[model samples]
Target: MLIFKNLGEMASLEYLYKYDMYFAIFQLTFIALLGYIILSWLFRMWKQYKQLKNDKASAELALLKSKIDPHFFFNTLNNLYGLAIKKSDEAPQVILKLSEIMRYTIYEGENETVLLKDEINYLEQYIEVHKIRYKKTVNITFTKVIEEENISVAPLLFIMLLENAFKHGVESLTNNAYINLELIVKKKTLIFSVENNFEVKENAQTGIGIENLKRRLQLIYPKKHELLIHKDTSVYKTQLTIQLK
Candidate 1:
């Protein structure tokens, strides 16, 4: 039986090697190899495209975060310097708060997302640091209504809005300026609002911080978020909403 099988295989090979069958064999092999090459190339191209898109997003996020972390820290340093110049007694407290803020900046800032409680604590630290720096009472308040526990959010997401509040709102007025922040968390929604009263400027343009925040939101949250801004002669308001699971 083995001898018969060997004889049949050889006969089939001999028929295939016949001169008249050469073109047919070549054509079949060519088509099969071409199909394989085309499939391989398409797969490679698809993989590269996916990789490139992911890398681009990662790099842009890193760049936006870099822009943010330094901007606020440097401004805080300036406040510290001001206190140092005046030899203010609260300088020590400010220094301690700033150190804690720096610790968060160095460690937690690198994470893609963090606990909602931790994020709120980070914001409070910023507020406390500024409160220590301010010479007069600026009337700052933070109100929250969260129905969820152990929520997670993108880190450093709201600091730019807070920074903008302080820069354009709190700093422009001589007195009677106020900054109000509100946070609401539902089962699948998060809303954060910042409102402040400021002296109107002659022709103030939007700053880089807000623009940076906008871009970051586009990258991180995409269609899952909303940023609303309203400004008038006396008040500037920003509300950000994110749909989270």
Candidate 2:
């Protein structure tokens, strides 16, 4: 106030002295603000780093999962062709169902996520067609413990697992073969459990289906999903649990 009241060189000296004491304070404040900005920028960079990692993993997993559809469709079509060549009475209905499965597998299966209930319906339809194709030899038992209206899941994820269970389990059975599915939704998590009976073969293999399912889970849910598979002398059991996002 005294510096502002006076004029000339005397006032200039007084004003400079007064604010000189605050010079260090202003420098410190500027430094603090700059540090804060740098820290915020680093935090944003770290978050982007994490997101990029997740995206890369997802892209790789999507590529792996994309491989599954071709193999699956090829095998299914081969199976259907065999049925056609046999001149079976159920061939017409089998073709219609195949068309539906193809549509779903090609179109809906490409999505990142889908209603869990819809995927389940697609699986049931596919299994039914397969049951018709393999009617004489395979016995399938499917049980649903979760209401389909309440849940959603990553699209086409569980189908490959189910397909593998049936392929290996059904192919090895001489008679009385059964595949059982139980879906349980508890709180915010969903548990899908499948068990199938199969004869012990010398050349049993865990094919591309299992690998694809693993990659899909890692990409889609990462630490939020759990997959467990148990193979005993005669029964193979698989359980996948995912925390709904």
Each prediction's whole-model lDDT (CA): 0.88, 0.80
lDDT of each residue in 1-245, candidate 2, tens digit only? 65655666777788898798699789999999999999999999999999999789877866876677454466667777887898877778878888887788778877777777788889888888877766466666677766446566778877877887777888778788888888787677898888998887887676788878887787778799999999988999999999987
Pairs clashing within candidate 1: none
Off by over 4 Å in 2: 1-19, 69-72
| Model 1 ranges with Cα > 4 A deviation | 1-33, 69-75, 82-88, 203-205
Clash pairs, candidate 2, are none
Tens digits of per-residue lDDT for model 1 on 107-173?
8988999999999998999999877767778999999999989999998888889988988888788
List TM-score per model, in order: 0.82, 0.81
